[model samples]
Target: MSGRIPRQFIDDLLVRVDIVDLIDSHVPLKKTGSNFVARCPFHTEKTPSFSVSRGKQMYHCFGCGASGNAISFLMDYSHLGFVEAVEDLAAFVGVDVPREIGGDFSASDKEDFTRLYAVLEDVAAFYVDQLRTGDGRIAVDYLKARGVSGEVARDFGLGYAPQAWDVLLGRFERDALIDAGMLVVREDGKVYDRFRGRLMFPIRDKRKRVIGFGGRVLDDSLPKYLNSPETAIFSKGKELYGLCELLQKKSRPERILIVEGYMDVIALAQYGVANVVATLGTATSKTQIDMLFRYASELVFCFDGDNAGRQAAWKAVDAALSCLRDGRQIKIMLLPQGHDPDSLIRDEGKAGFEQRIEQAQVLSDYFFDFLAGPLNLSSIEGRSQLMTAARPQVEKIPPGYFKDMMWRRLRELAGSRVVELPEKPSTLNRQFQGKVGKAKTQRPSLGRRVLALLIQRPELAQVLAQRHLSLEGLKFAGQELLEDVLRRIALEKPENGAILLEAYRGSSYEKTVNALAGVELDIPEGGEEAEFFGAVIQLLKQSRQEKLTELLAKEGREGLNAEEKQVLRALLRERL
Candidate 1:
């Protein structure tokens, strides 16, 4: 694989994958006027505050500060790296991601990893074919005995890898299988299939492309289930077992059920409760949580009713703090002792299993419950300890009613203890993002205004440049960033916010671009262009003042040269 992914692949992938189509596949959106609207998945909320623009091909949460384009959304939601997200997007849109390998392109270097994806799919088909062979009866009986109907088995892409050491070697190239994660090679040069003697589950991305596999041994084994190692297309921490099928449901599922095992997810599907997914031999990751939020507003984690399980749930609580936006719900369902989703659903059926879901503890209740478990909240020292532990987590949440509510709950737990709350963090670093739109700071500075205008109407960059304008001598806080933008604008001349944002992907000013791109400025409706020019004029005025200051400082420090004195006199002759 090439080390550096070309920018052209990213741009092409963005064009092929529409932002609305990508986000709506996860978050159920309703057509609202010209755009789509859904409750923001970033924070907890009661109404729709998230909006997707088909025109701009971007999304923004009016409630919390979360905002991005299609590629960024996948990175944040799926917890994928930049290259991984690009590959996944390209696969979704049926394009080949051309990676630029060392200098010029050769035929081998230009080959996209799509071929590896194809190999995995073929391997999945072979495993499914194996399940029907005479030697595969044990695997078939195992599924049938576990109550997996043939239709459900087919629905989940379940299969069985043959017990023979060289079963796959005869039909496929060993190196291709290795790259696709279907085979393992030893240092001694011995190579074998990775899933021999095991029932197979093909792990796919949201696009329904088979990327890797998970296998469970039928006999007594040290490790009961083994998943494919991370390949170009698969990251175990980022995928959920049944989400691809769950997303295809007609009525969007209101809450997603997260469990620990593949059978747990498949078993739930068998019982007609299909909103469940399984993490692949890992903890509930932040990417997993964020991805779950894309499909539903609420998530209920099904764990065993044991101390160990409670500890795991608490870990989930800690991981979820950073991603918890207002309007989203997270809960913990500790199943009765000695019962897992698979066994419990088999014993009590779907209704009984859902009863436990209904009774699961809300995140806030669990948050305090878990923290207060070791500390005595009744004592003053214990209260101080509790506050000390909870303050940092409370501050991490995005500004919303949910965060405000958590703070109040913490204060209530502290009884007469003084806890200082930080000032409200806004979506756009100002109070105007709140429902009241009250201005909490002074007027937007010349630097800030120039950034706002360029972000809102990106084409204005070309107009500003055509007029022979630049940041020049402006020395405000974001002046350096403004100059960078101006240079890229003059060189690349991107047309929209999405393209403009892409221009600064790995630049130091990425966060600033993200913040500026998503913010809806308070400029007057009809006079956007005029307002931008006006801001530019103010910025230039500040640049002139900055120049004047520099000249005066130079003269103060040492006697000015004759040319400097002439320039100073000319500048001072002009009226302020």
Candidate 2:
């Protein structure tokens, strides 16, 4: 059980696991042209905005900003850590994760995760075994009473925790229970079971490894449900119940419905709503929402009718707005009065509950009409308050045509004759003005121009360096970045930008690499290159003079350091 998984093993595993097949599991990808096309799972869209290039082994979503290789997609979509994602991918191709050369598990940082997985599996088996016993009959009866079928219970990995706390604590050592995050020990040295007298629901990762558990009390208890605390293997914020089974099915859900409790999820699935999942008694996070977007074209939030539910919906809406792009859509379904999903399924039946889903309001409609309703547009003060409240939400939206439409909608809502408020600034117009002003004020520095030229045609590197081209005059924070590039070129004698990037593999200059690699250099025509070279030399000379002047001012003639004196003499000599 050594930690280090060999790099070649991971690469071979990736080769075995077809990228297209892996991506297809999460999204409904149709063959389009040379690549596969699917409605971007990262955003809600009617038309396809996501494309997977099989040849390139990359996927990009045009609607949302999700672009990544196979590993990245798995990590983001499955909410798995880098190592966990690799292991999951490896498992899919039926390759064993390679162990380190030695018995030491420190080689790969995944040893803790691997051990946790083992512990969770053991706990799941214990729970399952307990559920089959006579004591488990109470848990089964409770589930049946709540309309959870045997199939649904099995599908969800439902089990039973005995009423006595020590029943579980006695089975495992204190360290083992603590490692599993199944027991909490008080300051008095008393160890207490995290879940007792409750129905156990195994929390699984995308690869279907039970990483944690959630337990619901069979009867009246202070806290109805208790979830496993965050452990090395479990993050409550990033996990979604039922995602593993849904992904395995490879059926793209039209819309993902997010609910609050585990019972709600079990209840929905029991009633044939297999696409529904519930947060682990926590607020919806951007990470969870992002994971949902990977498998679903649209998202519908089903919250309770109470004030708490309304507040949760608002938080979800705001979170979605921050992460969701133009093509993605989000809808909100507020359950009818005094109805939880568990109660609703029992009361109204599946079809009746679906009708409520059909009536779910789009995010735009919810924002403009429902959520923003408290602000009165009849009064001037009310109009001002509405605009103030709306600005921050609107600002959260990335700059684009969609933001413009939203601004116009806001102005129309707040500035109409009923309210007759001032017209809001157009996002596009402001962006255009800012771009023009920036272009006018900021001229490209000689150092930047030289670096760009070198990056575009590294043959120019020798010519530029031979002329003693210095980047000291550049008015940019990318000074150290340019220096790193120059150092790489000097050390490696790279014939091109690509070679230079390869040579500086572990350098802290990746931002420079990205900029240089992604951007097209504007090489001027005719004598412009010579003119640029001359300007660079002149700037360097001027910068040298300024350095000398500063040194002289700081340290008088009598107090002049050797380096300072030599630098002063060099500047004067250069001038002469």
Candidate 3:
């Protein structure tokens, strides 16, 4: 096993994998002629413009201009990392990824993930078995007392961890159990089950695989709820309690209701409101917000009306500031004091609970109300304070209609004491700067042409290499990058364009290489070799001409050195 996945395997996987089939599994594609077309999943569009070319094993969206191969498509659509995408493709094709044995990659890195997930699954089963046994009466009674039916209990994979500490210790290997976050090792080196005598709720990912657990005590415990410690498989800030189940109900629900606890989600589902999720004992995160927005446009947060609930709602607002965009909405719902979503929903039935969600305060109103709650807007001091606090939060939002409207609302609130914000460089200004740099690099230069052509048709590099072209003295902005890319292509001999792109993943020239890869050239099909060689030859000639001009100027300033004179004579002979 290698530390890094072998490059040859990745290229082979891309060659064997079908982009059309892979994408259709996620976003259905319809065959139109030799290619396939679908509504672009990356952006909202009415007509089908996303095209998948079976010949090239690549997909491109005309609407958004998003273009990539299978691996890139999976990375974008599923939000997977590059290696994970490659792993998925490898899994699809039924091949084990062979990695290099030596470097930073270790056996533990691979073994731990597999072992962790397996141990978690086994531990969840143990808890479930405990729930079914005679000793599980306490857990069963607790669920019944909470009005959780047997079917719902089973659906949520509710279980019971035994009161005995060694129950899990006896069943599984100690290290595996500890690594899965099922056991705690004290300083004395004594290990024990982390969730003893607690009713268990297995937290699953989108694949319905149990990644971690949330344990609630059957009796009076200070913490009340205990979640699995952050493990390789589970990050509290990233996972939602019932998201997998909610998504099972609706792939894209109209609106998702976010509650405060696990029971709140299960309770809401019991009451026939199935589109509810809960943050795992942590404050809502921007990552979770982004994930939820992928499934639903609107998110409604239900919190208790107490100070803690208000604090939680405010924290959610802070996290949501940077995530807000046009067409996405967030609402804050505060239940009556002394009640959480579980208690309130139980009291007010499904209809009343849902009514609260419907009448929930919009994010804009809640934001201003919370900001001004402690300040007197009539006084300049209070308004100044508001401006001081609000400006930073408002600026976190990406520029769009939402941001503009927020600014307008701030002005209305500030009234006579509106703060004049310092003008910063606009996004357009940054884009203009980038364009200027791009224009400089892309000025119909032979170097730029050759680089772009190589990225688009990397196999042409082999031909260029075979020509034994001497580009040693070539000097240009992107000349080194061009040579590096050509050298890699000539050595690796990657048959897929995505594989070539993937090779540049973390290189300094990754951005430039990707940008050039997307550049549309005027050369027709089968003319890439001619264009590539033509550009390379012209670039080399231009370098020579520039070198000759410099040497001639040096001769005028001072007599040329022996070496410089020889070079000048050879250049003059070549010119004649």
Candidate 4:
């Protein structure tokens, strides 16, 4: 709502929302000593790999390389946008999110979203009513024939689009419907209903606001299913149908089932198998996978047995690779030929369906089998081709025992361990590696070390500032940020990292602040004050020596004026 969330409010919010309690509410953590432990929600693993530090108000997962503070955890775990996560954390702690509106800021962006939600709600109700009308009777009959019940249909808010092109034009504003993706306007300037003579399923978000729609024709059609185009309110890739209901379930689900369509989701729910969601006219995307993982530890992707289905499953496998870590599991289940979940559920019923789910192939198993399916393992050339094709995809997965085991299995199948399969870090870990860099385990640079110490023990800023350090002369990668942080602490005197973090809360420096706050320093808790000043003094001495060298060069080459000569004298006069 403004330039940024006030630093004081964020600091206060952090105090109110304990990081442990906040993560535990979503992930169910067990206390062990001073920290809490849980399986990393970001990855698939059998043993717990996630740890939360009580002292630092931070959490890091050893298995998956996920690490962040309370707000970061909320964003990752709850799939909230940064601002949304901040607001959610504040709400969790019973505080309101405070905003600072600069002269250029306005509340219209937030207000526009609120209006869009209202428009979607009205469109959803209109669709629901259309299902019961005379023209919608055909759609009602179609659902009845498919074994969908009135109760279940109403629960899902199933609707019907009348055969007429402009049925909604008289009832609702055309522009609103178009913006909501319910109406289509062609280049020739003709406006008509986007979905016609079809059964409609409203797709809602986690907040239960209708964002989009999925529709299936009542009669035989070339393209059987149609979905709402991307709109201001909807992103096809990020959202899943029936996710709202999945989140609202009273009992925790052991795993989540992702299927192909909206009807598949509703039909499964009708059969009392409710831990299901459907991707909206798209292959499973990484964004959707992350959001789904928030509610369950395992993901079972249901695909058809055909080649197309296998292709889709592989896309999911690829998308899920960066997300896979210890404590999270991904499985692939292919329905029998000619059977989708909709038809299979009708034929096999719940008991038989459960058996098939139990038989779902684990990611490693499916991956190997899929790769081997097109190869002749008995031939050396075939085995070599198989290995070449698979190694790239296998390496995409995070470094773990699972990856190692998969490589071992592949080698065994190829009839050779002659060439060793060296383990590589996962793509996810590579990304995190880029953030922390090689410097994470190595000794930090002088500037970084000083900043880390100042962040951890903000009082060090006062000592450095009291010396009236010449920040302009400092040549470092983060000189400006370090100087700004020191200035804030020296002037405003934010007592700790918690309050210091507030200055960075909604700014570009937030990432740097988080990185510094989480980084481990070798200094003992009681010794940071000395370490801070010591690093700064060393930096100052280095800078003064460099200045003296430069001045000597200038006097030798270009010559120095009286003022420059005075500066050179001062540098020469300084002692270490």
Report the Cα RMSD per candidate.
7.4, 10.8, 7.1, 9.1
Local error of candidate 1 at 491, Å? 5.5
Off by over 4 Å in 2: 1-83, 87-109, 416-576
Per-residue error (Å), model 4, residue 3? 11
The superposed Cα distance between candidate 1 and the true structure at residue 345, in angstroms, equals 2.5
lDDT of 1 at 484: 73
Per TM-score, the best of the predicted structures is 3
* Cα lDDT tens digits for candidate 2, 221-282: 86888999988678899898777766665545777889998888888888888888889888
Model 4: per-residue Cα lDDT over 1-576, one tens digit each = 234777667766776667888888889999886678999887778999788867666777766566677777877766567777788888788875655776343456555666667777887788789877788888888888878899888878888877888988888767777777778888998998888888888888876888888889877884799988987668999889988877777324789999998888878988889899888878889988877777778999999999999999999998998788777899999999999998899899999998889889998888878889889999999899888987787777677877777778878888887547774653422333245534457777776777777776677767755777665566555667676787788676765565676567677676666676756665765677778778988887777788889889989999999998998888777753
> What TM-score does candidate 1 get on C-alpha atoms?
0.70
Candidate 4 similarity to native, TM-score: 0.67
Alpha-carbon shift of residue 186 in model 4 (angstroms): 2.0
TM-score of 2: 0.64
Kindly report which residue stretches of model 1 are placed more than 4 angstroms away from their true locations once superposed. Answer: 1-3, 7-112, 179-181, 184-188, 219-222, 250-252, 380-401, 416-418, 426-457, 461-488, 496-498, 504-576
Lowest summed lDDT window (length 10), candidate 3: 428-437
Model 1 agreement with the true structure over 1-576: per-residue lDDT tens digits: 436668766765666678899889878999987779999876679999888877667787766757678888887666456776887788778876675656544556434366787778888898899889976889999999998999999998899988888889889878788888777898998988887889998887776789788899999985899999998768888888888888766234789999989998888999999898898988889988887886678999888889888888988888888888987999999988999899998899889888889988999999998887789887989998988898888887877888888888899998854665557664432322222221313355556667867864677876666777665545666666676777777787565567677777787667667666665655555576777888888877776777777899999998799988986786678534
How do these models rank on lDDT, best leading? Answer: 3, 1, 4, 2
Candidate 3's residue-wise lDDT over 349-423, tens digit each?
988988888999999999999998899999989988888888899999877888888887888787743555435
